[model samples]
Target chain A: LAKTTQPISMDSYEGQEVNITCSHNNIATNDYITWYQQFPSQGPRFIIQGYKTKVTNEVASLFIPADRKSSTLSLPRVSLSDTAVYYCLVAKGSNYQLIWGAGTKLIIKP
Target chain B: SQTIHQWPATLVQPVGSPLSLECTVEGTSNPNLYWYRQAAGRGLQLLFYSVGIGQISSEVPQNLSASRPQDRQFILSSKKLLLSDSGFYLCAWSSRTEGPYNEQFFGPGTRLTVL
Candidate 1:
């Protein structure tokens, strides 16, 4: 199984860009990095997904280095509503199950 | 478009009581189903997943078990609830055919409170 590690929490100001990075040292060749955002008492919402390089969606962007050992989720001009627990995850192997980390609790301040 | 549904939005149960949580996906067939739990201020913990009907995989050993009686429905049940079982329960579905990424769609979630 591919385990991910991320910071427990972070703080950012409104209208500022935020980058939360995750480390998956033992990630397999087929593993894909993904991110999700969760608000209080709700299921996580998909933020972005990527295998290598970068993947950008309307909500956020995912940047993966060439080695694929780590990935960063970048939020541009974040707002207060973007404050949530952001999870970094990877698929294990042969289409492995999504393994989640402790997540980065992003706090967007005014 | 595809959507997933989980019932009884919120539930409260006493310790040692039986528990059942239902999740259904609409407008899709033969999806990869998953059951996840999140404690307060914590990340998601994958409990169970199903690739096909009657095929369930347990991730973490616990009092809870999962069943897939139909292609698009999954059930998470516990013969006897434990206080440790209390948390936010989420049901998700992904498409293997979509791609290698396997992006998942989640339901609204059920808040389980065991007293």
Candidate 2:
């Protein structure tokens, strides 16, 4: 499993966009970058996933650089309800194997 | 549409007592099941995974054991609980698909407190 590095915490205000970046320098060719959002006392939910370039979903967007060593999750117009921990995960295929990082605590202030 | 179910939502057990947590998947068949534990203020730790019935792979060496008795049913058990075992347990399932399109869906989670 590849290790991921992310900021321990971040602060943002409502209606502002938040972008959290993760670095996986040793990412393998088969590895895919995935992001998950976890609220207090709730299980992490899948936000977005990407292998290269950019991928957009109803909730967020994922941007992967050409090197595939790093990726960013962009949340548009974040709200107070978005205050939660965001985890960056790396995995391969349909296997149940996943490596989870400490996650970036995003505090969406009013 | 797929849904994962786990119970009991919260458990408070005494140390040295036996523990059993169950997880089941619905609307999907032959799904790959996983057991993960999230310590307070920490990240998730992969405990065990199963690809099929009677096949389990453990990622970490611990007192807990996992079993898959049916296609969509998985269980995490311990003969005797420990204080270190107290945490939030989550069960997840993913379809057997090729490539990197497989995204796991998680259950509500079970909070176990060992006293």
Candidate 2, which segments miss by more than 4 Å at Cα?
Answer: A93-96, B99-101
TM-score of 2: 0.95
Collision pairs in model 2: none
Clashing pairs in 1: none
In model 1, which regions exceed 4 Å deviation?
B98-100
Ten-residue stretch with the least lDDT total in model 1 chain A? A91-100
Residue-level lDDT tens digits of model 1 in B15-105: 9999999999999988999999988777889999888999988989999999999999999999999999999999999995754368788
Kindly list the per-residue Cα lDDT of model 2 for residues A1-110, writing each as its tens digit.
46889999999999999999999887877788899989988888888888899999899999999999899999999999999999999885445346677899999999
Q: Which CAPRI category fits model 1?
A: medium
Cα displacement (angstroms), candidate 1, residue B100, comes to 6.8
